[model samples]
Target: MAGPTTQEPVKTQQKCVAIFALLCCFAVLVVLIFSSVDIWGDNEDGITEENCSKNCRIVLVENIPDGLYLSMDGRRHLPLSVGFHELLDQAKHSVEVVSPVWDLNSWDVETMPSTAKQGQLLFQRLLSLKSHGVKLKIASSLNNSAELKTLAANSAEVHFVNMTALTKGGLHSSFWVVDRKHIYIGSADMDWRSLSKRKELGVMAYNCSCLALDLHRVFSFYWQLHERDYIPSIWSKRVTALYGKHAALELQLNATQATAYVSTSPDLFCPKDRTRDVDAIYQVIQSARTFIFISVTDYLPLVNRSFRGTTVTRYWSPIDEMIREAVVLKGVKVRLLISFWKKTHPLTFNFVTSLKSLCMQLHNCSLEVRFFSHREQKDDIQYGLNHNKYMVTDNTFYIGNHDWVGSEFAVNAGVGLVVRMTNSVKDKGMTILEHLKAVFERDWRSRYAKNL
Candidate 1:
């Protein structure tokens, strides 16, 4: 009996030892699997936001109308066409572009108009990129664009994002990422009007891989949703944002130290760590200490949605409320310059009037609204308009692709760049905030602007 009991205890001890050894093996296997797999989407060159160089050179690019000119300052800005060409010229490895439309070639016209020559040239240069052993990738929601078709046939990888199917809206994001080091973010699209006739404003950053990488993740997100009709339940880390409002990248832009970050719209489209467009705008407005200058094509505090085959509308008052608080409560001065074109919203005037009434009988409250009307001699419907979508405060500047519409923030896919600089950094050239503020003041005081 003693012998049997002693043997039983030893057998039990051996079983316990076996289980412990198996657990160790399992842990080792898990570590090896995760180590070999790319779960974090590390940079190809092993560059991270922490170790990457931050001395980024930034330039403000604008496209003024052929005839209309705003007399603000004598400084000449780099034209939009020249900026795009420079980006193409500097490309070595790859170029990724995201635009809502691809109507660069005016296929409807028999004789190519002079206005479209710049666009055609840009399209040709983009095509030549693939021939130079440089990869070209494009993301757009346009399905039947002849320009996109032609480019795709000639070594360009074009991916379609079904915006309507995904968000009941369209993609209005426009930007470019080159070689994972340079970027261009602005209000211009890949259309002829944007290149030649429309008044557009944007920024170009060179050697800003820290910021470029974050924007590239946005492009990668759209690229991965080419044929999918629904948002993915799980997202790859490759499409996740590297920096957001909570953790903006600190960089020396134009020899001035600043903090910058990128934000995206449509909450469903934002993956891990991406800031929402509405939230970004709120932060900018809330942080303003003195004055806020806003220029957008449209501003309406309403959202129209279609649900269950029925149309529904709601009052979206986040931005509107912020502006009122800034003026009435915080005593911050605010100026709004809205574009007045053929397609201007009828309800826009009503909203402007309401905003102006906030300061009717109050002290220390200043709010002004102006409509920028641009009329061309030829009466071209699409040209000769102020298409700027940006805002500049005392120390912050925001450049984005969406108009100040509630629907734009609720459903559309767009991107915004926020740059905050110290007021003490006074270099030879003007910083972005100063340049944009000057541009705003020039337009606000011009004859084209009319009081509400």
Candidate 2:
């Protein structure tokens, strides 16, 4: 009072300064926590600059092209002038082929005659390698009756794993890695259909260190699993004797240079539960920012018990729950492009119906769900099936052969690669997004000509 109203102004100024300081401190803490935990991006373990090498190019191939030498099929081109024939001829000690099925009459294997032609060729080749003291191992789903029979008959060491056991709910992946150097992964099966009929795509990479190492690890794991209890026959033993234990172990250990993950489905050979992978996928979806894009052949809703001691239905299907969370809670944009199969299995059809119901429930959410049926590009009426299963979110891409449906957890075998793109590289995310959008529009127009 003695100092008049001047003292009151000073006190008010001090309080305002204190409040501002507190706000600044809180903001700093928030930023620190986010940076440490990588809230803005995936942690180093998920992806790193070293893993995304620019030198590694991504080659996209559509339908299978002709004039390439067939490895799995027994029919060889006697007039072989292609690079495939050269690779086959260059085999120093061993050649091993893994396919869904092998037919001897096929041109690919018939060209190279051996005691084992067709399905038997794989076993025969291994045996021949064993005779030369070259170690050979072959892994395949025991579910394939013809292939399994040949495996049982082979004099070479054979390991049989039940695919059903390994993948309680998924498919067994098919791939071949040669000498821990070259790798071939694609949709082509070893059967006649894949070789001559089905539209397929795959890549053969050479001199790619990381890719080759990853393939080697995959093959090694399966080989170890196969050799766990079963002992090779005298022929295989003879071959092993030639290589010596140390050399074989060294080769196998060297093959595990790169870390790789294996996936399989419910088959007689591999019978295990895969709920963890499913949970991991959900976590990825929930954490996504910017956008989420998915193309699948089927969509199924997930059902689980609720905490209330009764069954409660969630608006978003189990597979789409994380997607919904990202869009509705995290402000992410989600787009789903699904194929509507005209002649689908009854169970699958019912599952699709459930998905539609779920989509209707999330209509107000920032998610776009569309079903596509192929319409001919030129002749409108003639159509093909859309059977791609993939997802691209921001700079991360998931390309695989399996559908993103709940049933995938139980019935089908699928494999895919997840790639993280660099900021400097040209991003294909937007390109894929535009392609999906165009396809969806075309299908929508065809579905309801006037309404669209």
Task: Write model 2 residue lDDT over 99-134, tens digit each, in one string.
Answer: 433342344545432411432433344445555555
Angstrom error at residue 114, model 2: 25
lDDT of 1: 0.87
- Worst ten in a row by lDDT for model 2: 236-245
Query: At residue 113, what lDDT does model 2 achieve?
Result: 27
Best by TM-score: 1
lDDT values for all models = 0.87, 0.43
Candidate 1 Cα misplacement greater than 4 A, ranges: 1-45, 108-115, 376-381
Q: Check candidate 1 and list the clashing pairs.
A: none
Per-residue CA lDDT of model 1 for 323-379, tens digit only, reads 999999999999999998887889999988999999988999999999998785445
Q: Estimate each model's TM-score.
A: 0.90, 0.51
RMSD of each: 4.7, 19.4
